[model samples]
Target: MTVGFVGAGRIGEPMVERLLAAGHQVHVYARRADVLERLVAAGAKPVDEVRELATCDVVVSCLYSDAQVLEVLPAIVAELDGLLISHTTGRPGTLQRLGHAAIVEAPFSGTADAVRAGRLTVYLAGEPEQVATARWIISSYAGPVVATGGRGTAMRVKLINNLLLAAITQATLRGLAAGRAMGIDESVLLEALAVSSGGSTAARQMDARGGSENYLAAITPFLRKDLVACRDAAAEVGVDLSDLLAAAYDGPMNLGV
Candidate 1:
């Protein structure tokens, strides 16, 4: 399949490489031309604007947030006639708003390492036929393409996954901080925690290396976005997430998870 990508930041760049390796004719559009020079050399035709993705069989977006996705959809749907895959997580409503396009949500799970290793799992959501087409395109890089549900289901699932990720990462940070305060060897606490329910993919990652509290600050913005989405989703369904919201807000401030 001939694939085109919008956004060429951290995740986008690696995904472009994966698609290229799978022998797809890939094209990419980025606001910053310099950032994508290597991709251009690697056979990815780079375009200055999003509208240039008109000729692709599938156009994928790895945008930062829901609003950004909305901002770009007009260009995508107007110019491209094929499936539009949203690689951004937590933006179901945005997909539904793109009229006429066969929109699919295929959010990436796992780290950049997973992307590079082609071990990523993408949650596919859309009309059944479009989703099957997306699954075929996604198989070039991702391991399993599970159909989560139709329309916005993938985004909601992604938000829930982020909630757990934020909670666990915060908890892991506090555990390390507590160990640090008491002068206990970080490795000992990490090893012990890995044997308990507190252990997670994030916790094990931190344990594998001596972890620090400072790392949480770097990821604060991403976690904040997750909190906002979670709160909004809960409100939409008349569910209360006051405690979880409070915890999410307090986690970084208190250095407690």
Candidate 2:
């Protein structure tokens, strides 16, 4: 299959590499010349513009946010002949607003490490035939291509997933800080938590990173963005997220330990 890729950042670059490895003819475009050049060196054809990708069988966008996706949608919709698989973790109504039936909502979970290791899980929402049409391309670099019925469902799931991620990580950091103040060694506290009912993926990640400080610093901005998006989504549906927002926001800001 001829696949066009937009945004060759960390996650996008590895996906393009995997597509090339799977024998797909991959065409790529990115504002970063260095990023695009790296993929071009690995067998992807570099396009001068996003619309140049219109000739491909599928166009996969791994951009950062809804704004970036919207910025490129006009050119893609006007010129593309095949499916548009968006991996952006944006608002629920974004897929419908794209106004293209061929567009599939395919927000994913996992980090760039998972992408390179082929362990990323994709949440797919579209018509059955549309999901099937893009499954092979998405599955080339992702695991467990989960179908969630119709458009917007996948983004809803992604937002919920991110909310839990933020909540759990913040809770883990607080637990570690409290334990340390009570005179327990950080490593011992983490090990005990690992086997206790309090164990979580977020705790394990913090342990793996040696401590919470650096990990928290590195992820705070990105996690804050997702949390804000979740808050907005919750507001649209009349759901109150005051407590969740307080925990997720205040903990990071007050991290003096």
Query: Which lDDT values do the candidates have, in the order given?
Result: 0.76, 0.82
Candidate 2 lDDT tens digits, 1-257: 89999977878999999899989999998889888878889999998988999889899999888788888876887877799999988788766777777988898887788888888899998888889987888777899789988887888888888777777877887888898899998888877776788978777766766767666766666666677678888999999988867766666444221
In terms of lDDT, which candidate is strongest? 2
lDDT (Cα, tens digit) per residue for candidate 1, span 200-256 = 866666665555444444455666776677778778888887776665555533422
Clashing pairs in 1: none
**Poorly placed runs, candidate 2 (over 4 Å):** 191-196, 253-257
Per-model TM against the reference: 0.89, 0.91
Q: What is the lDDT of residue 22 in candidate 1?
A: 82
Q: How far in Å is the alpha carbon of 220 misplaced in model 2?
A: 2.0
Number of the top-ranking candidate, with TM-score as the measure = 2
- How many residue pairs collide in each prediction? 0, 0
